[model samples]
Target: MNAEARNARWNVLGLLPAQLIMLATLIVPVGIIVLVSFSTRGPYGGFDYVFTTAPYRQILFNEGWTGELEFNPQYLIVVARTMILAAATTFICLLLSFPVAYFISLQKATAKMLLIYLVTLPFWVSMIVRVYSWIIILGNDGVIAKTLHALGLVDNMGSLLFTDTAMLIGLVYSYIPLMILPIFASIEKLDPALVEASHDLYGSRLTTLRRVILPLCRPGMMAGSILVFVPCLGAVLEPILLGGGKTMMMGNLIQLQFGAARNWPLGAAISIVLMAAVLVFLVWRGLRAIRRERAEAAA
Candidate 1:
């Protein structure tokens, strides 16, 4: 065989061990979850081999267990609200991150590094700590309220804790880094010459940004959206801690079933449904990306 063919064979062979380890660790556990989601729960809250659609039906109709997960009107409203929150959070993160990334891309190397470091500084602390800290910062007697009161900006204390706004703040704070990184990566690779060329061709800044910059950054935006949205869909910590446990997300619901309710199969089913939703979104993005790449190639 030629050298290139031999090298390709060796590369494939080299990847086999790591791939096998991943399959054993992740793929196997996911397969088990899928199976359990479709099966019945035992009396004591374990998987029973008896196959049933009751779990899925419960989720749809909000019936099984306490009948909440079923598709009743109240449950439907909650589910819809959850989806809306996820969508809103994703859209907002993208809108904010894009401009920050654009600004950073234009900065000198030292300033850019400092800005990027600031964006990621939160990661130096634990996520739980960050979420919990918001309570102190936004509570009735929290930092903002106290500071305002001290400065005579307000006559009375204002309660900001345990609200949807607080929840959103936590979500945005936690995931901003996740949104920024991919966009920065996409922007960093952009050719400065192209922007200059667009300007020379008499394109206004707005026109150049909309037409030239955004199109090239589409892939990055898509990737960053996925990074932010998928985790936000299942966000458990920020909501529970900052939203004062009033917020009920799929992640929280799934955890409740397995922990307090002692219903493994139902919990597994909810988890599977959540995973499926995320998978569908990812698949849609992947297909769109593939189509874009193909169209670009053809053109």
Candidate 2:
């Protein structure tokens, strides 16, 4: 019908700006990055406009070709370290978020709003400031180390700053709220009657939580997890600052390639690998979520 066609056209028109913005900001930028990752740079440190597989090769074999450039297990170990750090940060954030979210969910009218506001208030600060704040707090002269020294836990302040532990702390501090928000959103939307019914069936709190609440919360859990893990995986800033700017993570290595090492090709290659890793996680999470939804429907 003409009317149907007109309505469809209008609907699409309404979506046009959003689609354009998505393309401009997300799709276009990502496409350019991917394209650049496949190409090489000129000696002047700019794109050479020459396309080649040198970058991809560099990713796999970063020995004399790149840096301490011999095919080395050390590079792989650095990548593994980044992975472990990301995984640990995600896990800890997830674990902490649930309890905080549950506490918020148990609150009443004004209290719930206040608690949520308080929880999210920290997000108002710039991420850079938030990250750098940890540097001051965890440094040798920082409060915790100084306190520990005062308590005679050690004669000197702990070398707490610029270490793996500091990196983890910064990561967790940065992302805990992200994990918390989604879980809190899910918890907020949960039906109290369902929980009541579970309790009515003589289910223990633990059993009800394990069987009912956690399953219902999977979508949010998955969402929170993806948010945390994706950014955490390719993290550079925290590791660079708190991890002492060592060969700590892929992010750090990629920075080294493009900047200090003057090897744009190698940097781009590593970026592509990290992007692929992100895509894999996203796809896996999507599949899991779809299965969860189907299972819930069947139930």
Candidate 3:
């Protein structure tokens, strides 16, 4: 073969490992889930090999005692709660992270490195441990309650645990570092000249931030949001631990199906649905990003 063709062949060979890994990891598992989602539940636990659409059908409808399918909004409620919590967590992280990241980015090189290390120090501990710590802090008779009692703020020590507020606190604490790191990276790479130009043009502080800094940091903000939001959707620990099993999220529902519910088909179906929704969001974001890039190029 000629040199060009030989080099092209080697390049294709170089990509084989990555292709095989994706096939083994992503594609194969998804293919199995899709297959299972279309199958029927077994007589006992597990799934039957029989082909049926009952799993997906049951997502929105339930077979009644009289053998009639009735519309059910239970799972939809869980989905809505999951989305709201994830969105709220992402927004809160973004709000809290921007100032911290900007401050870190503005520090001297040594101080910046030290601050980054401090921000990431929490990651060294296990997530379960960190979550458990929040439980202690939010639980009745925990630190907050004790402090309140000492200050005579209230007659009784109040607890915030096992509530949506507690979940938000845990989620924000756990994911804020993720948001901060990405935004810090983006801000670090920003050109100071852009801010200087904005100020020179008689821009107010807010105007400079809105017109210059924010636009530059958009990519980082997007990345951080995706990182925080996606995991928050499937967060089993925070909801279970902080919400105290009173609040049900999509992850909890999926776990129930696979474990106690013993409805693999339904679980797989839910998994597929969640996966599809996330895939749609990611694709839309990617397309929008591509369009923006193209528009910028044209301009």
Highest TM-score scorer: 3
lDDT of 1 by residue, 1-299 (tens): 99999999999999999999999998999999989988888777777888898877776575456645435554345556667877788788999999999899889999999999999999999999988889899988899999999999997865988889888888888898888989999999999899999999999999999999998898788888888888887889977888888757777887887878778877888788778878897888789879988998999
Residue pairs with clashing backbones, model 1: 60-71, 61-70, 61-71, 62-67, 62-69, 62-70, 62-71, 63-67, 63-70
Evaluate model 1: give its TM-score.
0.91
lDDT, residue 270, model 3:
96
Q: In candidate 2, which residue pairs clash?
A: 63-69, 63-70, 64-69, 64-70
Assess candidate 3 and give its TM-score to the true structure.
Answer: 0.95
Decide which is better by lDDT, 1 or 2. 1
Report how far residue 12 has shifted in candidate 1, in Å: 2.2
**lDDT (0-100) at residue 30 of candidate 3?**
96
Better of 1 and 3 by lDDT: 3
Alpha-carbon RMSD, candidate 2: 2.6
Listed per candidate, the RMSD to the true structure in angstroms reads: 2.5, 2.6, 1.5
- Cα lDDT, model 1, residue 183: 93
Off by over 4 Å in 1: 62-76
Question: Which residue pairs show backbone clashes in model 3?
Answer: none
Best first by lDDT, ranked: 3, 1, 2
